[model samples]
Target chain A: MADDSTSNTPRDHGDKTIEFSGLVCPVPLQDYPNIILGHGGGGKLSADLVQHVFLPAFQNDHLAVLGDSAVFQLAGVQLAGQRLAMSTDSYVVRPLFFPGGSIGDLVVNGTVNDLAMSGATPLYLTAAFILEEGFPIAQLKRIADAMGAAARRAGVAIISGDTKVVERGHGDGCYINTAGVGIVPDGIDIAPNHTRPGDVVILSGTLGDHGMAIMSVREGLEFDAEIRSDSAPLADMVAGIIQVCPDVHTLRDPTRGGLSASLNEIAAASGCGIVIDETRLPIHPTVQSACEILGFDPLLVANEGKLVCMVPAESADAVLNAIRSDKHGSGAAIIGRVVADHPGVVVAKTAIGASRVVVAPIGEQLPRIC
Target chain B: MADDSTSNTPRDHGDKTIEFSGLVCPVPLQDYPNIILGHGGGGKLSADLVQHVFLPAFQNDHLAVLGDSAVFQLAGVQLAGQRLAMSTDSYVVRPLFFPGGSIGDLVVNGTVNDLAMSGATPLYLTAAFILEEGFPIAQLKRIADAMGAAARRAGVAIISGDTKVVERGHGDGCYINTAGVGIVPDGIDIAPNHTRPGDVVILSGTLGDHGMAIMSVREGLEFDAEIRSDSAPLADMVAGIIQVCPDVHTLRDPTRGGLSASLNEIAAASGCGIVIDETRLPIHPTVQSACEILGFDPLLVANEGKLVCMVPAESADAVLNAIRSDKHGSGAAIIGRVVADHPGVVVAKTAIGASRVVVAPIGEQLPRIC
Candidate 1:
């Protein structure tokens, strides 16, 4: 009752304004009559859902930043006077396992990366498993092993966990929910809202690999060359950047909605414009052809192990070099720069020199891409 | 790979000792060749699953203690030099709403109580929702609203959350996973392993109310009186007891496997014997009758808001008085005491004077009661 609020912000209930406040008046999202798979795709639809549905319901200071992780200072709770970052994510990627990863590791790395986005060192993780009865024991063991291996690689402990089993048909094999806690250093203060006009945006690596990996496995689409899911713990890479550039403004993993949604989120959160060079976008040759064959945009494809950073222009080179030093960031490149004009917009400079708006897809181009 | 270990404890390789360490030789659990509803029922089967499955896979120092929550000290990370407690639980109760509570509040209180069991003051919670497509938005709003109220009641913030939607029929209406963090005051070290001989065990209130409440509504069982869920936040009550009796050895909410399981776990973990008086056990008449009619054991029925505290005999009276002072613990009673004999066992003194082994059920008598 205390949190319930009906937004007084006047808007054509039917209009396509990014309405952040209001009653759940079933104002049909002009294009989406029902929640399509894209709504969960981490694209424009997912963003809209968070902005229009979740934010209105749970509008708090920590959540207002719209960062991958919520970083806040818990005063007097600790002796070192350090801030803390906490995050939660549910992994529902279908097929469970694909070329390079499974839901188990995805569960760990997903939350780990979220903490990394806040410039925190992940320390502990909690896993909750929703299992469908009749699921194979062998499969469950495989997942657990992968989770253990992944946690070890990330130097975090799966300290607490829970498991609930639904009736056989009520659930797919399993859905994992993970929450993480990380300690943020005193000097580091990174969030999406901290982005400024002169900041430069850098991509940690290639895009579309994770989404296509899931799509290919689920749809049985085979390519001449295997496209593995680019799922890895990004904390080490993040630490590298922070080591050299502690004042980095923002860091986000371009997950569900691909790179476009991530850029748009930072743009909106900071009220700035982002201009990216299309030619500078890194896409593997096989991935490019596969996206073309499947009629999917590489720019809008999900990636799990990559990140986008908005750092001060002066710190860009050091940050880029620091990221490149990590094995996960070999494909790092400067893709864009923050601009003063067209605030709250993301633009892409075409290879031919014309600039076009890089709008986030309304929903996910591929479902269950993780 | 680092955590992988096969049991070194030698067994016949064929005996059914519920071997803790060994090969995954499918020792068919007598009658259960595969997972049954009872496997998830906080009974014997659930314990076995955790011991033979989860514990072996995720064996860590924190989990080895077997407390409702894992309390660990994060040194130098806090300014005031404090320890923190964290816990996670997934609520999959069917029917969504019962008489006194729903899965939403359960998600909050469950984790809060877990943190409380560690003698910590719960401060923050993270919620993750897995929704079934086509689930009425109205129902979701109702659930979220309930969660907000519960978090407010528990004096904890729902700081971060995630939402994932699965295709209709693939999931029940919704499954909520909540992970919580709390501040454990200095000099407070409460754990299952801390239970000592001569510790008096106190029951906060009536038993079997929550499970019976859910069972009645689900089975359409009519009763002379309504059985309301005993769902409330126990953190305040726990704090009350800790304030008066700081040496409270152990605290556990009789959830899942109910009182018998909680007692059994504490006994096994602490290597102590527990003797409980059946005559002192508090049970609502309506709930007792319902359990009788349904052929359910009251000892194995779940309680949501209630807790069992083990305190030194000298401080028992003060702890009991403090618990009774709290609204949620009005019916608090001393039901048992720790003993030097028969370590790792629980014995109930029957109303007729005979003592019987109070064994934890292998599975829940009622599925999804919590």
Candidate 2:
């Protein structure tokens, strides 16, 4: 039975010669009581959950092999006006409300950003809610209001949604899962594989603010801290960038595992190496200190509002300038460039001229932030 | 502040002109009483929890306006090998271990049936899971193994997925939500709108078996009669019928609210009328006795492995035979037809020439059974 289960697990890449069953999650659900926090921790637990539960539920020819994203041929079918970019996200933050932004804004912006990353003009969103009993009506009202303001700001339509309540003990105060649909523009070729050597990497503004802010509040740690979540919409910026460079290699919002995970993903997906100078890495001084004090690498922290862009080197300067001109991206920096050899390596050079391999994050730096 | 909050409250479809406003969940984290069953109940309190806690956190343009289902424009982007159909559904039926099948198999086939209703050939699926702390690992393995078998039977793959574990008492044993994407063949236009006068309606199999089975186990009411969940994939059957006749007008699984909700949704979406002869509706004698004893209307009950199809009058024989040829659909029956006038009404003519209206579900008929 166990052998049958293992043989049926979905493959990561399409090649039969190269299988990836070696990377095991620490908290295997198959051996545990139920799911643990580590399941969402993006370590072995997360991987195991995907392999055991999700992969089998949807064993499609296209999805049987996982990729950075699912790709289907868009050959000669009618994909005209209603080209949509749809995405869904579930938010389980420690606190339902947070500094600078609350759950409402996070839900709306999270999905919109996903659409934007797909190079689709994010136009519509759908929010589905599973609420617990006894949650205050006033609090629910607050989230709805925040969602409205965020939608208006993002210039998208809050179109459709669903709401259901689970019994109190069956759920927390709430768990919101959102699915979005956006139209992928015509003549655009934006994909993770589009990354190539000589492509320049851009970081929009400072990092670690959102993750740090949540960490401080949740942990009750005080820093002469004026730090707040860098939570805001980047659709406008994404649109402008895509307008200029419709074929940009990859665009990712460095959210949960911050810059480290995003960069590692690109490196692995494109089968290339990335080189970055620590001096050019953007970090708020306070955030840098917070990371140092907590013994957490700023690169491994989360950022709710920042994006990572990989564009052709010649358009690097133009793209950086354009991003910098935007209020949300004033601190934009040309952080790194893609390289051909030494694939799947993300390297950062220190001020002292030493290079350290910044491996992909094993799991969660801050739990339940997004 | 009150006016803003009121404006932001998540609006229902009862009010089409919606403006989203709501605050984050205001309940204190430390004060949370352990989770309870009511949180999953589809009631006003559940809506409140979602609005205050979940929606605010993840609010986006599309998620604010709650609807039966979100309507999307296909535009020009061709999916799979043709134009497409897409949908999503979450299953949290009680008793992870159930008669005939588990939640895993139900979820896979449920979403597949949804896509096929639009005459879309099942292609890819995305599965997301929320697992409760302390759930039995063996049971989870059982469910996952069942899901893999169902997907193999359905000929689909799960492409993308997410898994999260809520703190103990904050979630049920587990809940599974699936999103399916399928290809709709060209010149094979099927939807609610395709139903015209004289269009023949077909019922794929027995009614109320699934709902009764779940209810029996949930209520702990056993009988001399044997009952099992009629859970099975409909993709093969849909493909088979579509191949013989590309003009299959409508296809729907008689799930949640059973024959009633499916027909009502189609009637409303297509702005047509349906006349179903109650005598022609196939109800297993055991299921009939069970519903009679429980005071449940089979029409308003649920079915996991049943379909209600509408085909041209001339092709009804081919359609019925095509469906009957499948092992899962051996008991298929020609049930009714579509009418041009008296739109949005689904009426059942009884043996005594009396007609009764099938209205939309009035509220929670059976919660968490999906």
Candidate 3:
């Protein structure tokens, strides 16, 4: 694990060789040799990277919580007890425009959703753009306009922005990073670690639509029905859930490594087992068909507008009803439950009445899905 | 200005022509025919791009103020009267590592300083990284360590982070975007539009060290003395100044297009004229020599750790004292004063007793100086 490959001399590890001059390696290289796309895929690899690299360097009481967003209080007389949530995500989806949504919409909705997952009322966002030198100004304007529309729909103001242009060919046309700040109302505390053994898992909507939408565009494969990205804001739906059940244990948006990743994270964070019935998952027909064609599993595919919630069994019905009342969460359904046995694991009951462990993907099945 | 170049057919504008397919342009393209390096140089071109593109798209009450950070209040009863500041910046400097500082330090300090500029006590930060595939993980750890150290020095916590990797050749090693949130104490308000006719301009320290440091390393030019980047955090100094002079009108860091750009922005935003004595501008001798050799104007060169402050004449002495007491501002000096004549213009009093208009650079004198 202690791979000292950045020395003046060349060093070989397994099948990979790395060499550099006049630079010292500060942290030990563990597991993977070099950073692969999967390291950013929010799966086992992404988690490993965070555990070994980022967490150690930036460990703090707030970050250690590792919720969708960092929740903290302002330390001033006027702002005492004001809990704020902040989160950031960078969007680098290929084929900037896709069915039902564009990268612009994804960037805004993605960060908003992350903050929403923390049970916060997202208020303002900051956007930064990294554009290729020759990127069309017209396309930029379109993206910006789309972002504006999305922010308006989400009821969040884009209060600050920065733009940088890399030399042509150094970027994929454009990439955007948005950071959002939201307020967590009193009595609403949601985090992965808050999950309890008696919590019921509810999914807000269909899965795989967002991932399949991007995949279809990239692969040029078509089905009888068009699949659109489920890229919509979930803050209102989340607010409704909190209003109905303020003791909601956890909330997660299935993005990047998708449902499996989110479920595994919650299980690990809470030291509880999650059991889901595969047949109960709400997947769109077109998305299911596309996933079949692409050899993808809907369970591991991304969804931008969907969320998974963990609430006490007694409050499950109320939370589900609140979620169903929202347009974005009309398809909400109960899919699973948390258990004390088999802690830090997730199990799926198959249609054939057999049960199997549902493992998080090591990397991304669909790169840049969000 | 309405350049509809995203149509399937080609379109020509003056000497430059642009053509795209299947996309519609939503905003008018003005000034520059295409996105250039200058658009991200933080000079006039950069300002034009924001004025024409970003501002129109993301215009809001908070954003329209155009302070270093957006200052706003939470809408809830618990957080009422609590004003918060948020700012974001992206660092894409070449040769990731340079004398006295690296991109890691810049990423942390840059955002911290921006929040400090708004008279906010820097509190939390979120960082997102876009890394190129095949980049050494060991180097990444080193950068992460540097970021951690810088955050510690700035007295801020990096509470959240996201990482994404582009395929090799699609990125220049790494680019980091950091967004910071800070709490503004009651009765403290700082913004460019608050500048008044009787405000005295004070500079914290010497200029051009950061840009020159990067330039010296990039150009492989060795001078008699090593030019180190003054990439230090200014939050503590700012807090001290605010404590002494709560009514400080404006604060700006001389980053990307440097002092010229910052002064020009204050002049334009406040509708006030600024007159600076060139002889009083504090500049390191080595930096001056480097600028002469590189044909770069010190006024147009970037400084990572310096700040320009605008305060009423009565508070100038106290503010200067507050600044000078801090190590980062030991060389604090009054270089200029705001004037009612020639609003929206900045002038320099040359050593020969003659004055000349100091126009903001049309583009970056030194690209990626930050």
Candidate 4:
């Protein structure tokens, strides 16, 4: 985790940017070998490794492309306003089988949510995997069965995919990295920067259920109330919301860093402040109790089946109603309002009437141990 | 480093069934709350992990997909007697700065070579990075600069990318994963299955430069003659060969598992025998010295810039002539020939006329310590 100093320069984020100070490492990339691990480490060396070794091989117009997401004219709609959104995310939840969902469900739902967040119609997905040396035959059949069911529930096609097996120990039990390509609805341009101070923040359900559930299972701990993961696909809920209101400003799923990290990201990107009411947040009794005992903040926990939306002040109610219509969003609640005072910051009104600033999480409680 | 099981499986090679009876532990994707490092250990747990988790997530499309690499379709091509080919790889090589190439160069060239091996026109690429906390700003700039340059040389755009930062320690310095899509030319269907007796096996340039470069730098062992990584892009060379003879049989880069493993795979996949003249195999003098001192087999070493190409008996001379025209392929040589005996096995002809069977490497000597 030592690539921080190289990232926080005066060129891009401003020399005074205080972002990534904790999560970013401060190690100078150590170049060893004709190559070394850092090249794959996702640090400077990794970037350089790709640039120097790969780019020149097959230089072409398409290969020269670069963007957060590729923009193209899929339908009659052009790029700016009426473009379809497509994306993918491979869920490598450590436990193939979770307290609630299995890797099968996670793969479909994870990518569906990604497309939904981009305001896309989740149409199709591609699931690929790297199997290790000595995998069991029966276990594979069960997982395949789970995937088929999950895809059917999501109403999307498993379309196509790939698989490969590394020698044992070369790979984890199984690593699923999915690539989903969907079409963003026409006349919709939802991005991180679309959030406005006047927007109302809505959460589809209780926070931290998925993260806490996984954590509990991993840590071998339990609460009085069984805390099961809320790892369901959200594309349907997103479609339902769009059907009710098309003027949503922004959408995002608070996954890795949970709601707090997601809100802060939206705030920073939109240069707006977000104020949340702690009382408005819907936390399951089991999740709350687990957080209390674990000494971990629910805001920083991970989530598998949750979405955060910042809608126009005018359509917040309709959006909420539409989301609540879906079983996945039965716990829908209006949690906050985007504000102007603390640009790039998320401030929460505590249950005790006090205010606290929740910044992005420093590190993951659960490591690739994903 | 995990996810090495590529979906390289195609419908054609149904004969090569990988029997892992001796493998330690396969992908026994059980219902787990948290998976251990053993899943990636490349042994029994590794196989079980993949079988249980990944295989189900991506039910085995084919044995190739279940084996080491995946052979997938490339988009936008419907030529007679041909199929497009696409492959992708993640470069998490540690030590951002390497002897010769950086992560930037690796990504571009790695993807390019993959398409090249399929006799495809390596066209588009997408690079995604997960950076850890505290990466250096200056180093990132260097990598970006290097990436731009590499893309320029390769004559390709980086196309698109996504960046996510993990908390320090949770991630190494950084992890760069790339997905590439290419167009396979018509009249060209080159895969391991295409090999047959009387086919000529060609080795382009030198071997082990990339792997040795990584090892020496990582271990801090300096050779009298400094060794640099052979991490150049090979798309141009591929293009050269394709242009001259579209009938060229196969193109494959020997990377992670090295030439030995790659050759063995091709042998098994084709259900044919390969006899390589080990004495004629190319190895940089300095690299050979490093491998000797480290007690590493040169054949097991990685090659980022080079490729193993098996051409049709009729086109062998033309292919070699074509390859020698390019700088990267100037050192290409006829290393061996395909035979009928020892089906699904590679045989290297020793200098003294001794023959030793080379099976597809069972495991990685250089662990994901990629």
Worst 10 residues of 1 chain A by lDDT: A1-10
- State the weakest 10-residue window (summed lDDT) of model 1 chain B: B1-10
For candidate 3, the per-residue lDDT at A231 reads 97
2 versus 4: better TM-score goes to: 2
Which numbered prediction scores highest in DockQ against the true structure? 3
Q: Higher lDDT: candidate 3 or 4?
A: 3
Model 1: per-residue lDDT, tens digit, A1-370? 2322222122345544553222122333423323445556666656666666566665577766667888877655534557789999988889998999999879989999999999999998888888887665557778888888898899888888877778878888788899999988878999988999999999999888998888878778888899999999999999999999999999999988889889988888898989999999999988898888888889888888999999999999999999999999999999999998888888899999999888766765776666
- What are the RMSD figures for all models against the true structure? 5.4, 8.1, 6.3, 8.9
> TM-score of chain B only, all predictions?
0.91, 0.80, 0.92, 0.82
- Model 2, global lDDT: 0.71
Regions of candidate 3 where Cα sits further than 4 Å from its true position: A1-30, B1-29, B78-80
- lDDT (Cα, tens digit) per residue for candidate 4, span B224-288: 88788777777788888877777676667887667886777677567777889999998889988
What's the candidate order when arranged by decreasing lDDT? 3, 1, 2, 4
Per-residue lDDT tens digits for candidate 4, residues A1-370, read: 2643344422333233344323333333333222332333223443444455444533443333321234333222122343434454434466777688777777677767777787776655555555554555345556767877787787765544444444544444555555554556767667778888889999999988887777788889966777887888888888887877787888888776678768876876788889999999999988988888888788877788889999988999999999999999989999999988868878899989999887655434544312
Interface DockQ of each model = 0.41, 0.25, 0.48, 0.08
Model 2 has how many clashing residue pairs? 72
lDDT of 3 by residue, A1-370 (tens): 2645433222334454211122222332345546777777888767777888788887778878887899988875455456889999988888899998999999999999999999999999999999887677778888988999999999999999898888777788899999999988877889998999989999999988999999999999988999999999999999899888989989999998889999989988998999999999999898988888889999899898999999999999999999999999889999999999888888999999999888777776887776
| True lDDT of residue A115, candidate 2 | 69
What TM-score would every model get versus the actual structure? 0.92, 0.77, 0.93, 0.70
